[model samples]
Target chain A: MDKLPVNHMQLDRLVLDWMAEVRTYILKEIQRPIIVNTKSNMRDLVTNLDQNVEKIYIEKIKQYDPNAQILSEEGFGDEITDLTGPVWIIDPIDGTMNFIKQRDEYASMLAYFYDGQAQGAWIMDVVKNEIVHGGPFQKVWLNQNLMEPPVERSLEQSLLSFSGIHLLYDHFQYQTMARAALGYRVYGSAGISFIRLLKGQLGGFTSVLKPWDFAAGLILCQALGLQVKTLDGQTVNVLSSNVILAAQSLVATDIKMLTNTSSNL
Target chain B: MDKLPVNHMQLDRLVLDWMAEVRTYILKEIQRPIIVNTKSNMRDLVTNLDQNVEKIYIEKIKQYDPNAQILSEEGFGDEITDLTGPVWIIDPIDGTMNFIKQRDEYASMLAYFYDGQAQGAWIMDVVKNEIVHGGPFQKVWLNQNLMEPPVERSLEQSLLSFSGIHLLYDHFQYQTMARAALGYRVYGSAGISFIRLLKGQLGGFTSVLKPWDFAAGLILCQALGLQVKTLDGQTVNVLSSNVILAAQSLVATDIKMLTNTSSNL
Candidate 1:
């Protein structure tokens, strides 16, 4: 393991304090007029609120750990190629489109890694004013309460969250998987999707996601003994964008079996 | 016009007070165990709370208007083929699956029609504790404040609410319609979809709906200058199940053009 200036508990406390401040700023800022700009396309969006939140997190991280490497959605963080030392990943606002349009169902996320392994993670449901946070060093929590492990159920009896684009275009046999499940929901936010999974409201979720979008959620899901894998049933890389799947082990097995059979034909 | 025992304002006050009682009952009942059962299939659920709420509305309606007819989801109200006299439509819990599993995004809706014309309507977003109510007799209101008309935008610049079953099965050229919008969301409840449309968060919604499901929303949408029609661009009959499309006039025109072109091809 890489050596760090502060211990895991100390780093965790610092992150919690920053999140509280960030949440207050977001709630206040949304009441005022916001400036929005498109990123890769009209469907993809970024807002001034996203940038300001990212800047707040980066400044605080730099002050506490001057040498900490950072990877983030906005360009304010470092250009990171490796996760060899103490690293922090930030998604200032995980669902920017939802933030700009609906003003709800968005989240702020942060994950800490040491020697390419997760040390701690935090995800805040900004509108609801609650956070689900923890990692390997400490058990997971929803705000001040301890989070219990989600109950596992069969795919035939659970609600699955599949990408709306994939369902419409029939990519990766998503339509077949959806038919096998009890029902389908599309929330348009990965952070909110993970929150539902952690609460056992959803059996599984599959979507194309970036590193910052999945980093904090991946850590929280793993700590709860949920399976985190690529679409082809392989482990997920912490630094690259891929089609990610997170669910209970049984549900994952069922999804893979159903999708593979349809693809074979 | 058919004569009635009471005027529109008196009936509206009675429904509003009943909704407040129903909200308190549901919030408290959910804290305890709920009895859930299948209606049409495993995916179509009805709970004890749903039945109880429907009974509450039925009793109150009968007490207030002794000869009033009711069309309801849970079979607690009267059955009539014609809409000649005073008729009340009630959907005790609009999204029963969401209520049983997610504990949010469901609603209780009621509409009053006399001589086949809407007098008033009310939909309560139970969790949020806010109600959107109004009709031809009066303008729309969100809680205590009057609602402003939603801004009209073209299909390419707006978000849409669509049924997941239709998207997965490729019914009615839904995939084409979804592609034309800024994005797609599926919340699984017509009442919630209507609330989003009323708030201008969604530009349009399309789904297969029963009378109780669309009655309240249709009245409120029409009061706000939205177009409510069948998939083929015909006016909706307020008494039967149909594939309904509710949207701003510009977005509706674009959706109809896109779907018509694809179906012809």
Candidate 2:
């Protein structure tokens, strides 16, 4: 594959513009009824809107950079056995179940990375018409104006969003822990819940999410100066599944310890 | 206490007006910084806004009925060990953790019943500024417009919302039954989740919630034409704490089967 020579700025701008296009596709498809397919029992799902949304972006990406590698949920992208070179990791719709069911909490997520380094990312909440974006500028934006990191608070005093399954199945000892607040919450939308984390509503959050799910969210959190990593405190593999993501450096520390008991860090 | 004639029409208007007032209160409070206090370890919360919001409604109720009984979360209402006449059940901030942290997904809930006969109920979604009122109408408004129930899918084809500690800890074997869906979901708020159930996003829902937490929602579901009852297939109690609630009528059969093995149901 031949490499393109656009700097991060040009690429970021194109990605932002591309996000708007994807948002249009999302809104159009969302109002109509969706076709749902099961992936793993009822816990996993694939919607027609997911495929339609991803294909729309991939077609446009090909027009923008014919040589660009695409990692998409719909299998329209590259072979992508590994993450290498200018790959556009697209979830199109990060919270598919929420999209298929509620149509409100779901988000359209897009992440662009070069040589495994995320150059820019976006999580567009379609119903709300807000795209949370982040890049080298170290800012998160709804559109134009920048967003601040969440209100400073401790996990013990803040609301936490965790996959109730993980909290139950993972044996994190969270059940016995003193951290459960009266406000302990769960949104079930990784992107929307992550946005809430950045907005200062949740002190921290944890969930078994996919790469396309966390890609845009990671950039948004990093831009807001919060800590994010896999449950084991390892750098997230943008190609894998079952990753747990969180906010607040403090909350991340406790989460890392709880989820990965072997890690003394 | 002197028993006076119950004015159904007047109380309906009062319930509607009081709900509107609390909706405004929620909007104003959302903008202010939240002060979250920890309760029941760090997971449960009791925010200043929670208490304040409850206080406002308590005072209003007192003025309206003068002799009407009240049960509220913030200790601002009343105390009676038994079901009484024309009592008002209120959960000022039904999703307090969401209110304290997310500033969205929370509701100001109130249910009025005359000696246990359901009369009126309100669930005002704060951020959307939409009132899901069903006492007088068959339609549920998302904002200014009416909302149709989510596509009429079967339980196996729906997305669920049940995230109480009991789902995993107490071993909710019925998980296999609800898991028959396109996905299994959990939210932090029983009140908020039940309203979503009314939206038909989930084919059914089950949650262990308090009386105040579900009284208004129970009345709302009844008004919206959704099947709602305690998990045991009994009508809900307006005064006693309810351990389980499901919106779909079919769910009643399966969930009851799951809990029948244990006397817990």
Candidate of highest lDDT: 1
Could you give candidate 2's per-residue lDDT for residues B1-265 as a string of tens digits? 3243455545656766877777787688768877877776555678888888888888888898788888887777888566567688888887766665566777778887776666667777766666666553334444445666554565555666675555545445545544454556556676667767877767676776778888777877776667777666777765676656565655555556545754454
Which candidate number would show the highest TM-score if scored against the true structure? Answer: 1
**lDDT of candidate 1 over A105-129, digit per residue (tens):** 8999999888898889999999988
What lDDT does the true structure give each of the candidates?
0.89, 0.70
TM-score of each: 0.95, 0.85
Q: Clashing residue pairs in candidate 1, if any?
A: none
Candidate 1 regions with alpha-carbon error over 4 angstroms: A1-10, B1-11
TM-score of chain B of each: 0.96, 0.83
**Model 1 interface DockQ:** 0.67
* Model 1 lDDT tens row, B1-265: 4264446666667778999999999999999999999978788889999999999999998998888999999998877798998999999999888898789889999998888888899999999887999887668989888898898989988889988787778788888888889888988889999999888888899999999999999999999999889989888888899899999999999998888788789
- Could you say which candidate leads in DockQ? 1
For model 2, what is the C-alpha lDDT against the true structure?
Answer: 0.70
Model 1 chain B lowest lDDT segment of ten: B1-10
DockQ of each: 0.67, 0.41
Candidate 1 displacement at residue A115 in angstroms: 1.6
